[model samples]
Target: MSFLKRPNDFLFRTLVIVASVSLATLSLLVIYSVVMRYVFSDAPDFVEPIALLLVIVIAMFGAALKVREGGHIGLDSLVNKLPPRGQLVATAFQHGCLIVFAIALFFGCLQMVEATMEDRIPIIGLPESLRYCVPVIASVCIAMFSLENLLALFAQKQK
Candidate 1:
Protein backbone atom coordinates (compact mmCIF):
# COMPACT_ATOMS: atom_id res chain seq x y z
CA MET A 1 0.00 0.00 0.00
CA SER A 2 1.00 3.61 -0.46
CA PHE A 3 1.10 3.82 3.33
CA LEU A 4 4.42 2.04 3.15
CA LYS A 5 5.95 5.43 2.35
CA ARG A 6 4.67 6.92 5.58
CA PRO A 7 8.01 6.81 7.37
CA ASN A 8 9.76 8.86 4.71
CA ASP A 9 6.83 11.22 4.56
CA PHE A 10 6.89 11.59 8.33
CA LEU A 11 10.61 12.32 8.38
CA PHE A 12 10.32 14.88 5.58
CA ARG A 13 7.48 16.68 7.34
CA THR A 14 9.26 16.66 10.70
CA LEU A 15 12.47 18.01 9.22
CA VAL A 16 10.58 20.79 7.46
CA ILE A 17 8.85 21.82 10.67
CA VAL A 18 12.06 21.69 12.69
CA ALA A 19 13.95 23.70 10.09
CA SER A 20 11.25 26.34 9.87
CA VAL A 21 11.10 26.79 13.63
CA SER A 22 14.85 26.87 13.97
CA LEU A 23 15.14 29.49 11.24
CA ALA A 24 12.59 31.72 12.94
CA THR A 25 14.26 31.29 16.32
CA LEU A 26 17.65 32.03 14.79
CA SER A 27 16.35 35.25 13.27
CA LEU A 28 14.90 36.42 16.56
CA LEU A 29 18.02 35.52 18.46
CA VAL A 30 20.17 37.44 15.99
CA ILE A 31 18.01 40.51 16.32
CA TYR A 32 18.07 40.30 20.09
CA SER A 33 21.82 39.81 20.15
CA VAL A 34 22.34 42.84 17.91
CA VAL A 35 20.05 45.05 19.97
CA MET A 36 21.68 44.00 23.20
CA ARG A 37 25.12 44.66 21.79
CA TYR A 38 24.50 48.06 20.20
CA VAL A 39 21.74 49.54 22.36
CA PHE A 40 22.41 48.07 25.79
CA SER A 41 26.17 47.57 25.41
CA ASP A 42 25.69 44.05 26.76
CA ALA A 43 25.22 40.94 24.69
CA PRO A 44 24.78 37.62 26.37
CA ASP A 45 27.79 35.45 25.73
CA PHE A 46 25.53 32.41 25.40
CA VAL A 47 23.68 33.92 22.49
CA GLU A 48 26.41 33.22 19.95
CA PRO A 49 26.76 29.53 20.69
CA ILE A 50 23.02 29.08 20.88
CA ALA A 51 22.54 30.82 17.57
CA LEU A 52 25.28 28.69 16.05
CA LEU A 53 23.52 25.54 17.19
CA LEU A 54 20.23 26.74 15.75
CA VAL A 55 21.91 27.61 12.48
CA ILE A 56 23.39 24.16 12.20
CA VAL A 57 20.08 22.54 12.97
CA ILE A 58 18.23 24.69 10.47
CA ALA A 59 20.74 24.22 7.68
CA MET A 60 21.24 20.48 8.02
CA PHE A 61 17.60 19.65 8.49
CA GLY A 62 16.64 21.86 5.60
CA ALA A 63 19.21 20.16 3.43
CA ALA A 64 17.95 16.71 4.36
CA LEU A 65 14.41 17.80 3.63
CA LYS A 66 15.48 19.07 0.25
CA VAL A 67 17.05 15.70 -0.49
CA ARG A 68 13.87 13.95 0.55
CA GLU A 69 11.85 16.18 -1.76
CA GLY A 70 14.17 15.72 -4.73
CA GLY A 71 14.79 19.44 -4.56
CA HIS A 72 18.55 19.32 -4.59
CA ILE A 73 20.32 20.66 -7.67
CA GLY A 74 21.49 18.23 -10.30
CA LEU A 75 22.01 17.74 -14.03
CA ASP A 76 18.44 16.66 -14.50
CA SER A 77 18.34 17.76 -18.11
CA LEU A 78 21.08 15.28 -18.96
CA VAL A 79 19.38 12.49 -17.06
CA ASN A 80 16.13 13.26 -18.80
CA LYS A 81 17.71 12.75 -22.17
CA LEU A 82 18.30 9.09 -21.46
CA PRO A 83 15.78 6.34 -22.11
CA PRO A 84 13.31 5.29 -19.40
CA ARG A 85 15.45 2.45 -18.10
CA GLY A 86 18.53 4.62 -18.32
CA GLN A 87 16.79 7.31 -16.33
CA LEU A 88 15.93 4.84 -13.62
CA VAL A 89 19.51 3.58 -13.54
CA ALA A 90 20.86 7.09 -13.31
CA THR A 91 18.48 8.02 -10.54
CA ALA A 92 19.23 4.92 -8.57
CA PHE A 93 22.95 5.49 -8.95
CA GLN A 94 22.57 9.04 -7.72
CA HIS A 95 20.67 7.98 -4.62
CA GLY A 96 23.13 5.16 -4.00
CA CYS A 97 25.96 7.66 -3.96
CA LEU A 98 23.93 9.80 -1.56
CA ILE A 99 23.52 6.80 0.74
CA VAL A 100 27.25 6.18 0.76
CA PHE A 101 28.03 9.81 1.40
CA ALA A 102 25.49 10.03 4.19
CA ILE A 103 26.93 6.94 5.84
CA ALA A 104 30.40 8.43 5.70
CA LEU A 105 29.16 11.72 7.14
CA PHE A 106 27.41 9.88 9.94
CA PHE A 107 30.54 8.07 11.08
CA GLY A 108 32.72 11.10 10.54
CA CYS A 109 30.52 13.15 12.82
CA LEU A 110 30.42 10.34 15.34
CA GLN A 111 34.21 10.31 15.52
CA MET A 112 34.31 14.09 15.72
CA VAL A 113 31.85 14.10 18.58
CA GLU A 114 33.79 11.42 20.39
CA ALA A 115 37.00 13.38 20.00
CA THR A 116 35.43 16.61 21.23
CA MET A 117 33.36 15.25 24.11
CA GLU A 118 35.97 16.50 26.54
CA ASP A 119 35.79 20.02 25.23
CA ARG A 120 33.06 22.52 26.10
CA ILE A 121 31.76 25.70 24.59
CA PRO A 122 33.17 28.40 26.86
CA ILE A 123 30.01 30.51 26.88
CA ILE A 124 27.30 27.88 27.27
CA GLY A 125 29.40 25.16 28.90
CA LEU A 126 27.91 22.69 26.45
CA PRO A 127 29.97 19.77 25.32
CA GLU A 128 31.72 20.57 22.03
CA SER A 129 30.30 17.32 20.74
CA LEU A 130 26.99 19.11 20.66
CA ARG A 131 28.28 21.08 17.68
CA TYR A 132 28.53 17.90 15.61
CA CYS A 133 25.23 16.37 16.61
CA VAL A 134 23.27 18.13 13.86
CA PRO A 135 25.33 16.53 11.16
CA VAL A 136 24.86 13.12 12.72
CA ILE A 137 21.11 13.49 12.84
CA ALA A 138 20.94 14.99 9.36
CA SER A 139 23.03 12.17 7.98
CA VAL A 140 20.63 9.62 9.41
CA CYS A 141 17.70 11.41 7.82
CA ILE A 142 19.46 11.67 4.48
CA ALA A 143 20.41 8.01 4.54
CA MET A 144 16.86 6.99 5.29
CA PHE A 145 15.48 9.12 2.50
CA SER A 146 18.01 7.87 0.00
CA LEU A 147 17.41 4.25 0.99
CA GLU A 148 13.68 4.72 0.57
CA ASN A 149 14.15 6.24 -2.86
CA LEU A 150 16.48 3.45 -3.89
CA LEU A 151 14.00 0.82 -2.77
CA ALA A 152 11.20 2.58 -4.57
CA LEU A 153 13.27 2.69 -7.74
CA PHE A 154 13.90 -1.05 -7.56
CA ALA A 155 10.26 -1.71 -6.90
CA GLN A 156 9.34 0.27 -9.96
CA LYS A 157 11.78 -1.77 -11.96
CA GLN A 158 10.21 -4.98 -10.70
CA LYS A 159 6.77 -3.76 -11.64
Candidate 2:
Protein backbone atom coordinates (compact mmCIF):
# COMPACT_ATOMS: atom_id res chain seq x y z
CA MET A 1 0.00 0.00 0.00
CA SER A 2 2.84 2.40 0.80
CA PHE A 3 4.47 1.52 -2.51
CA LEU A 4 1.23 2.21 -4.33
CA LYS A 5 0.91 5.52 -2.53
CA ARG A 6 4.15 6.88 -3.90
CA PRO A 7 3.34 5.97 -7.48
CA ASN A 8 -0.24 7.21 -7.16
CA ASP A 9 0.94 10.53 -5.82
CA PHE A 10 3.36 10.85 -8.70
CA LEU A 11 0.68 10.00 -11.20
CA PHE A 12 -1.77 12.48 -9.69
CA ARG A 13 0.81 15.25 -9.79
CA THR A 14 1.76 14.40 -13.35
CA LEU A 15 -1.87 14.42 -14.47
CA VAL A 16 -2.45 17.77 -12.77
CA ILE A 17 0.49 19.29 -14.58
CA VAL A 18 -0.49 17.78 -17.90
CA ALA A 19 -4.09 18.93 -17.57
CA SER A 20 -3.11 22.43 -16.53
CA VAL A 21 -0.72 22.81 -19.41
CA SER A 22 -3.23 21.45 -21.86
CA LEU A 23 -5.89 23.90 -20.68
CA ALA A 24 -3.54 26.87 -20.92
CA THR A 25 -2.34 25.82 -24.34
CA LEU A 26 -5.86 25.27 -25.55
CA SER A 27 -6.92 28.73 -24.41
CA LEU A 28 -3.99 30.39 -26.15
CA LEU A 29 -4.51 28.39 -29.31
CA VAL A 30 -8.16 29.33 -29.46
CA ILE A 31 -7.31 32.97 -28.93
CA TYR A 32 -4.71 32.83 -31.63
CA SER A 33 -7.11 31.16 -34.00
CA VAL A 34 -9.76 33.78 -33.37
CA VAL A 35 -7.29 36.57 -33.85
CA MET A 36 -5.93 35.13 -37.03
CA ARG A 37 -9.39 34.55 -38.43
CA TYR A 38 -10.88 37.93 -37.58
CA VAL A 39 -7.87 40.24 -37.70
CA PHE A 40 -5.66 38.66 -40.30
CA SER A 41 -8.32 36.77 -42.21
CA ASP A 42 -5.90 33.83 -42.42
CA ALA A 43 -6.69 31.28 -39.73
CA PRO A 44 -4.25 28.42 -39.83
CA ASP A 45 -5.84 25.18 -41.00
CA PHE A 46 -3.95 23.16 -38.41
CA VAL A 47 -5.39 25.09 -35.47
CA GLU A 48 -8.73 23.30 -35.37
CA PRO A 49 -7.34 19.78 -35.26
CA ILE A 50 -4.62 20.75 -32.81
CA ALA A 51 -7.18 22.44 -30.59
CA LEU A 52 -9.34 19.35 -30.74
CA LEU A 53 -6.45 17.23 -29.52
CA LEU A 54 -5.70 19.67 -26.69
CA VAL A 55 -9.36 19.60 -25.67
CA ILE A 56 -9.25 15.82 -25.39
CA VAL A 57 -6.11 16.05 -23.28
CA ILE A 58 -7.66 18.63 -20.97
CA ALA A 59 -10.98 16.83 -20.58
CA MET A 60 -9.75 13.28 -20.11
CA PHE A 61 -6.93 14.19 -17.76
CA GLY A 62 -9.16 16.54 -15.78
CA ALA A 63 -11.78 13.83 -15.29
CA ALA A 64 -9.20 11.33 -14.03
CA LEU A 65 -7.75 13.86 -11.61
CA LYS A 66 -11.19 14.70 -10.29
CA VAL A 67 -11.87 11.05 -9.55
CA ARG A 68 -8.74 10.76 -7.43
CA GLU A 69 -9.71 13.87 -5.49
CA GLY A 70 -13.31 12.74 -5.03
CA GLY A 71 -14.34 15.96 -6.68
CA HIS A 72 -16.54 14.56 -9.41
CA ILE A 73 -20.30 14.90 -9.17
CA GLY A 74 -21.85 12.34 -6.82
CA LEU A 75 -24.67 11.64 -4.40
CA ASP A 76 -22.37 12.48 -1.54
CA SER A 77 -25.03 13.98 0.70
CA LEU A 78 -27.04 10.78 0.65
CA VAL A 79 -23.98 8.61 1.21
CA ASN A 80 -22.87 10.79 4.10
CA LYS A 81 -26.21 10.40 5.79
CA LEU A 82 -25.78 6.63 6.05
CA PRO A 83 -24.24 4.79 9.02
CA PRO A 84 -20.54 4.01 8.92
CA ARG A 85 -20.91 0.55 7.40
CA GLY A 86 -23.47 1.69 4.95
CA GLN A 87 -21.26 4.61 3.95
CA LEU A 88 -18.43 2.17 3.36
CA VAL A 89 -20.66 0.00 1.21
CA ALA A 90 -21.83 2.98 -0.81
CA THR A 91 -18.32 4.24 -1.34
CA ALA A 92 -17.09 0.83 -2.39
CA PHE A 93 -19.98 0.53 -4.78
CA GLN A 94 -19.09 3.88 -6.30
CA HIS A 95 -15.52 2.86 -6.78
CA GLY A 96 -16.59 -0.42 -8.30
CA CYS A 97 -18.80 1.38 -10.77
CA LEU A 98 -15.96 3.67 -11.73
CA ILE A 99 -13.66 0.73 -12.27
CA VAL A 100 -16.24 -0.96 -14.47
CA PHE A 101 -16.80 2.19 -16.48
CA ALA A 102 -13.08 2.76 -16.89
CA ILE A 103 -12.49 -0.77 -18.07
CA ALA A 104 -15.28 -0.43 -20.59
CA LEU A 105 -13.94 2.92 -21.74
CA PHE A 106 -10.44 1.50 -22.14
CA PHE A 107 -11.52 -1.43 -24.29
CA GLY A 108 -13.86 0.72 -26.35
CA CYS A 109 -11.11 3.23 -26.98
CA LEU A 110 -8.74 0.44 -27.93
CA GLN A 111 -11.19 -0.78 -30.53
CA MET A 112 -11.60 2.73 -31.88
CA VAL A 113 -7.86 3.15 -32.04
CA GLU A 114 -7.43 -0.09 -33.92
CA ALA A 115 -10.24 0.65 -36.32
CA THR A 116 -9.02 4.16 -37.10
CA MET A 117 -5.29 3.54 -37.13
CA GLU A 118 -5.03 3.92 -40.86
CA ASP A 119 -7.22 6.99 -41.04
CA ARG A 120 -5.61 10.43 -40.68
CA ILE A 121 -7.03 13.63 -39.34
CA PRO A 122 -7.34 16.32 -42.00
CA ILE A 123 -4.85 19.24 -41.91
CA ILE A 124 -2.77 17.45 -39.24
CA GLY A 125 -1.86 14.23 -41.04
CA LEU A 126 -1.88 12.43 -37.70
CA PRO A 127 -3.63 9.12 -37.19
CA GLU A 128 -7.31 9.58 -36.39
CA SER A 129 -6.80 7.06 -33.63
CA LEU A 130 -4.63 9.50 -31.73
CA ARG A 131 -7.82 11.11 -30.44
CA TYR A 132 -9.05 7.90 -28.86
CA CYS A 133 -5.64 7.10 -27.35
CA VAL A 134 -5.97 9.93 -24.84
CA PRO A 135 -9.17 8.41 -23.45
CA VAL A 136 -7.45 5.02 -23.20
CA ILE A 137 -4.72 6.50 -21.07
CA ALA A 138 -7.22 8.40 -18.96
CA SER A 139 -9.32 5.26 -18.49
CA VAL A 140 -6.35 3.41 -17.07
CA CYS A 141 -5.72 6.26 -14.68
CA ILE A 142 -9.37 6.29 -13.66
CA ALA A 143 -9.31 2.59 -12.91
CA MET A 144 -6.14 2.90 -10.87
CA PHE A 145 -7.48 5.83 -8.91
CA SER A 146 -10.74 4.07 -8.20
CA LEU A 147 -8.93 0.97 -7.02
CA GLU A 148 -6.75 3.06 -4.78
CA ASN A 149 -9.82 4.68 -3.26
CA LEU A 150 -11.45 1.31 -2.67
CA LEU A 151 -8.34 -0.02 -0.99
CA ALA A 152 -8.09 3.02 1.22
CA LEU A 153 -11.76 2.72 2.13
CA PHE A 154 -11.38 -0.89 3.30
CA ALA A 155 -8.15 -0.14 5.11
CA GLN A 156 -9.84 2.63 7.05
CA LYS A 157 -12.70 0.32 7.86
CA GLN A 158 -10.28 -2.14 9.44
CA LYS A 159 -9.29 0.41 12.02
Candidate 3:
Protein backbone atom coordinates (compact mmCIF):
# COMPACT_ATOMS: atom_id res chain seq x y z
CA MET A 1 0.00 0.00 0.00
CA SER A 2 1.12 3.54 -0.58
CA PHE A 3 2.57 5.35 2.43
CA LEU A 4 -0.09 8.08 2.36
CA LYS A 5 -3.10 5.77 2.15
CA ARG A 6 -3.14 4.42 5.70
CA PRO A 7 -2.60 7.77 7.37
CA ASN A 8 -5.63 9.33 5.71
CA ASP A 9 -8.00 6.36 5.54
CA PHE A 10 -10.36 7.46 8.28
CA LEU A 11 -10.44 11.15 7.47
CA PHE A 12 -10.61 10.52 3.76
CA ARG A 13 -13.48 8.04 4.07
CA THR A 14 -15.36 10.38 6.36
CA LEU A 15 -14.95 13.24 3.92
CA VAL A 16 -16.18 11.07 1.05
CA ILE A 17 -19.29 10.13 2.99
CA VAL A 18 -19.92 13.70 4.05
CA ALA A 19 -19.48 15.05 0.53
CA SER A 20 -21.75 12.38 -0.97
CA VAL A 21 -24.52 12.82 1.59
CA SER A 22 -24.34 16.61 1.36
CA LEU A 23 -24.68 16.48 -2.40
CA ALA A 24 -27.68 14.14 -2.20
CA THR A 25 -29.25 16.34 0.43
CA LEU A 26 -28.63 19.42 -1.66
CA SER A 27 -30.42 17.84 -4.61
CA LEU A 28 -33.40 16.90 -2.50
CA LEU A 29 -33.54 20.34 -0.91
CA VAL A 30 -33.61 22.01 -4.28
CA ILE A 31 -36.34 19.69 -5.54
CA TYR A 32 -38.42 20.26 -2.46
CA SER A 33 -37.97 24.00 -2.69
CA VAL A 34 -39.07 24.04 -6.31
CA VAL A 35 -42.12 21.96 -5.53
CA MET A 36 -43.08 24.10 -2.56
CA ARG A 37 -42.67 27.30 -4.54
CA TYR A 38 -44.83 26.11 -7.42
CA VAL A 39 -47.48 24.25 -5.45
CA PHE A 40 -47.85 26.48 -2.41
CA SER A 41 -46.54 29.71 -3.85
CA ASP A 42 -44.13 29.84 -0.95
CA ALA A 43 -40.90 28.07 -0.11
CA PRO A 44 -38.92 27.71 3.05
CA ASP A 45 -36.53 30.64 3.34
CA PHE A 46 -33.77 28.35 4.53
CA VAL A 47 -33.57 26.32 1.34
CA GLU A 48 -31.57 28.67 -0.87
CA PRO A 49 -28.86 29.59 1.63
CA ILE A 50 -28.57 26.01 2.86
CA ALA A 51 -28.25 24.82 -0.71
CA LEU A 52 -25.49 27.35 -1.32
CA LEU A 53 -23.63 26.15 1.74
CA LEU A 54 -24.00 22.54 0.66
CA VAL A 55 -22.57 23.38 -2.74
CA ILE A 56 -19.42 24.75 -1.14
CA VAL A 57 -19.14 21.75 1.18
CA ILE A 58 -19.57 19.29 -1.66
CA ALA A 59 -17.12 21.00 -3.97
CA MET A 60 -14.36 21.78 -1.47
CA PHE A 61 -14.29 18.55 0.51
CA GLY A 62 -14.61 16.47 -2.65
CA ALA A 63 -11.74 18.35 -4.24
CA ALA A 64 -9.62 17.89 -1.12
CA LEU A 65 -10.20 14.14 -1.15
CA LYS A 66 -9.28 14.05 -4.81
CA VAL A 67 -6.06 15.87 -3.94
CA ARG A 68 -5.36 13.28 -1.25
CA GLU A 69 -5.81 10.51 -3.77
CA GLY A 70 -3.54 12.28 -6.26
CA GLY A 71 -6.47 12.21 -8.64
CA HIS A 72 -7.10 15.89 -9.17
CA ILE A 73 -7.50 16.70 -12.88
CA GLY A 74 -4.28 17.68 -14.65
CA LEU A 75 -2.79 17.98 -18.09
CA ASP A 76 -0.72 14.80 -17.97
CA SER A 77 -0.36 13.85 -21.59
CA LEU A 78 2.88 15.74 -22.12
CA VAL A 79 4.17 14.98 -18.65
CA ASN A 80 3.64 11.26 -19.25
CA LYS A 81 5.76 11.38 -22.38
CA LEU A 82 8.71 12.95 -20.60
CA PRO A 83 11.76 10.90 -19.58
CA PRO A 84 11.74 9.67 -15.98
CA ARG A 85 13.83 12.52 -14.57
CA GLY A 86 11.87 15.04 -16.58
CA GLN A 87 8.67 13.55 -15.27
CA LEU A 88 9.95 13.89 -11.72
CA VAL A 89 10.80 17.51 -12.34
CA ALA A 90 7.38 18.16 -13.77
CA THR A 91 5.61 16.44 -10.87
CA ALA A 92 7.69 18.31 -8.29
CA PHE A 93 6.83 21.56 -10.00
CA GLN A 94 3.16 20.72 -9.97
CA HIS A 95 3.22 19.77 -6.31
CA GLY A 96 5.10 22.91 -5.45
CA CYS A 97 2.50 25.02 -7.21
CA LEU A 98 -0.29 23.15 -5.44
CA ILE A 99 1.34 23.65 -2.06
CA VAL A 100 1.64 27.39 -2.66
CA PHE A 101 -1.94 27.64 -3.84
CA ALA A 102 -3.30 25.66 -0.92
CA ILE A 103 -1.48 27.81 1.59
CA ALA A 104 -2.69 30.99 -0.09
CA LEU A 105 -6.27 29.73 -0.19
CA PHE A 106 -6.21 28.72 3.46
CA PHE A 107 -5.06 32.14 4.56
CA GLY A 108 -7.48 33.87 2.24
CA CYS A 109 -10.34 31.86 3.69
CA LEU A 110 -9.20 32.81 7.17
CA GLN A 111 -9.27 36.48 6.30
CA MET A 112 -12.70 36.14 4.77
CA VAL A 113 -14.02 34.36 7.82
CA GLU A 114 -12.56 37.01 10.07
CA ALA A 115 -13.99 39.86 8.05
CA THR A 116 -17.45 38.25 7.82
CA MET A 117 -17.74 37.12 11.42
CA GLU A 118 -20.57 39.52 12.22
CA ASP A 119 -22.47 39.15 8.98
CA ARG A 120 -25.42 36.73 8.86
CA ILE A 121 -27.31 34.79 6.29
CA PRO A 122 -30.67 36.47 5.72
CA ILE A 123 -32.88 33.48 6.42
CA ILE A 124 -31.08 31.50 9.12
CA GLY A 125 -29.12 34.32 10.73
CA LEU A 126 -26.09 32.06 10.83
CA PRO A 127 -22.80 33.89 10.67
CA GLU A 128 -21.56 34.42 7.15
CA SER A 129 -18.15 33.22 8.26
CA LEU A 130 -19.55 29.69 8.39
CA ARG A 131 -19.40 29.54 4.62
CA TYR A 132 -15.62 29.88 4.62
CA CYS A 133 -15.19 26.88 6.89
CA VAL A 134 -15.13 24.39 4.04
CA PRO A 135 -12.46 26.25 2.09
CA VAL A 136 -10.35 26.70 5.20
CA ILE A 137 -10.60 23.05 6.17
CA ALA A 138 -10.17 21.75 2.66
CA SER A 139 -7.21 23.97 1.95
CA VAL A 140 -5.37 22.61 4.96
CA CYS A 141 -6.05 19.10 3.78
CA ILE A 142 -4.85 19.96 0.29
CA ALA A 143 -1.68 21.56 1.62
CA MET A 144 -0.90 18.54 3.77
CA PHE A 145 -1.41 16.18 0.88
CA SER A 146 0.77 18.27 -1.38
CA LEU A 147 3.51 18.49 1.22
CA GLU A 148 3.36 14.74 1.80
CA ASN A 149 3.75 14.11 -1.91
CA LEU A 150 6.65 16.52 -2.03
CA LEU A 151 8.33 14.74 0.84
CA ALA A 152 7.74 11.34 -0.71
CA LEU A 153 9.26 12.55 -3.93
CA PHE A 154 12.44 13.62 -2.18
CA ALA A 155 12.49 10.46 -0.08
CA GLN A 156 12.40 8.37 -3.21
CA LYS A 157 15.32 10.28 -4.62
CA GLN A 158 17.35 9.71 -1.46
CA LYS A 159 16.69 5.96 -1.64
lDDT against the true structure, per candidate, is: 0.88, 0.93, 0.88
Model 2 lDDT per residue over 1-159, tens place: 676778889989999999899889988999999999999999899998999999999999999999999887679999999998899898899999999999999999999999999999998999999999999999999999999988999888888
Query: If ranked by lDDT, best first, what sequence of candidates would result?
Result: 2, 1, 3
Question: Once superposed on the true structure, which residue ranges of model 2 sit more than 4 Å away at CA?
Answer: none
Mind giving the per-residue lDDT tens digits that candidate 3 earns over 35-85? 999999998889989999999999999888888778877669998999999
The stretch of ten residues in a row with the least summed lDDT in candidate 3 is 1-10
Cα misplacement distance, residue 145 of candidate 3 (Å)? 1.5
TM-score of each: 0.90, 0.96, 0.89
lDDT of 2: 0.93
Error of 1 at 128 (Å): 0.6
Among these predictions, the greatest TM-score belongs to: 2
Output the lDDT of residue 72, model 3: 79
| Candidates sorted on TM-score, descending | 2, 1, 3
The prediction achieving the highest lDDT against the true structure is: 2
* Count of clashing residue pairs in every prediction: 0, 0, 0
Screening candidate 2 with a backbone cut-off below 3 angstroms (N, C-alpha, C), the clashing residue pairs are none
